[model samples]
Target: MTESETVRLGARIRAYRTMRRLTVRGLAGLAGASPSFVSQLERGRTSASVGMLRRISGALGITVADLFNEDDGAGHRVVRRLERPELPAGPGTRKYLISQRPLQNLEVYAGEFEPGASTGGEPYSHGDSQEILLVLRGRVTVWLGPPAEAVANTLAPGDSVEYRTSIPHRVVNDGDGTAEVLWVVSPPTPL
Candidate 1:
């Protein structure tokens, strides 16, 4: 491969390794290679032979062709507005999935909430991950914790909050108009 192609290939390998939650040493052990070699390959400081790539790809539980997919696992991609998929949501609410499918370490959603619309009747949890909710327009209330003693924060445009997804949470539109927001989450949760 050319130098640029080699760099991109290294990036794909690194992305796949991370998605599989494998350490460099762990992957090297599985691939029958040295940890230093894997590290060098991932950092674009060195190139791997076809055989080495095969071993690495096998260790990652993917075919060599998958490594060359256009998605590049975690590389640059663009999702046009028209291509965003609509998601099933609670009453008076609409959500668009802004992140690409076969999700990587992160996922995003664009939400539109009509007056009094809420995520659910009660708080909900999403495994163990980090999440950020950013209000883009109108006003909304975010509730975190059990229903009995939930903490509610009313947010306006430009406001954002970060929290752990393990905590039960819900969001509601508090204004008379529609509320627009973005939800950014890491280590994506299943839809």
Candidate 2:
């Protein structure tokens, strides 16, 4: 990354960390990093690898893409399709941040997944908010709760589901082809 970009990244990290009310040490512990490392990274004195950035973003309940965007969800009423920032995902999976940063009441995302791609191997919860997932193409399976006692629902085009964000959940593309989905969350929460 360029010098300016690195500084901006550090600023974003600091902003999110502060907004989450986490100290440098707390963030380091959650991200499996050292406090000094996080401090330096936030101060723009150092750079982080992709792996480190992913871990930190995960710990902060945000997407890596959020670290690069500067939009604060103010004054902009529309987000152009070609200008949407993308979140790093697993192979064959694409996640886009359709909503601006420092989310107000709502957060949105659009995703495309190749067959067999999934959000993750395990379910994860963000906070106490409401979420709606709508399938726009192909098929997907939504898993709620831990793997041991999870509820799975297969969704086709136009299918939608509403659930609490506090409940651990995962989404998988279980179709024969690529699947597209839209996620809308109210009272925006991290992750």
Candidate 3:
């Protein structure tokens, strides 16, 4: 891998590891490699074989594509004219993407929620990854974990939170006004 590619891959690996709260030793054991090897991989000091990459992806619960995709720079020029696929989660929720395709290190999205809007499903857990949410407008109530710990966080604008995704989590708009959040998912989520 080139230096840039290695750096991007390393960033993705590190993001996933932190999201999962997995130590180098833990991931190394899961990948059947040494801690040193895992560290080298995360630092981009060494390249992993196809088999090894697959093993690592499997251990991380993500696809190989999620780890190697390149940024196309499609929707970053201007804020108003960015064409992004609006993923329909449920009624009253809208999702806008800052990228048309998934990149190696980060996934950016603009999300809007109507009053009483919710993620509209059971709390879901991704692979080894962390999520950051920045509320641009209104207030939102986020619940984390299968036990559903109510997060008493309310954001009017320019407020954000980053958390591990290993536990189940959901976001809801419990206030009267619509909520807008800029969400970034690290290590990318498989399309």
Global Cα lDDT for candidate 1: 0.85
> Which lDDT tens digits does candidate 2 get at residues 91-158?
88999988776554578999999999999888988866789999999999999987899999999999
Residue-pair clashes per candidate:
0, 0, 0
In model 2, which runs have C-alpha deviations exceeding 4 angstroms?
Answer: 1-76
lDDT of 2: 0.88
Over 105-149, each residue of candidate 1 has an lDDT whose tens digit, in order, gives 788999999999999788999655689999999999999888888
The CA lDDT at 22 in model 2 is: 72
Candidate that would win on lDDT = 2
Candidate 3 residue lDDT tens string, 124-191: 67755778888889888777767446454566678787877666778889889999888888766544
Candidate that scores best on TM-score:
1
TM-score, predicted candidate 2 vs. hidden true structure: 0.62
> Could you give the candidate ranking by TM-score, starting with the highest?
1, 2, 3
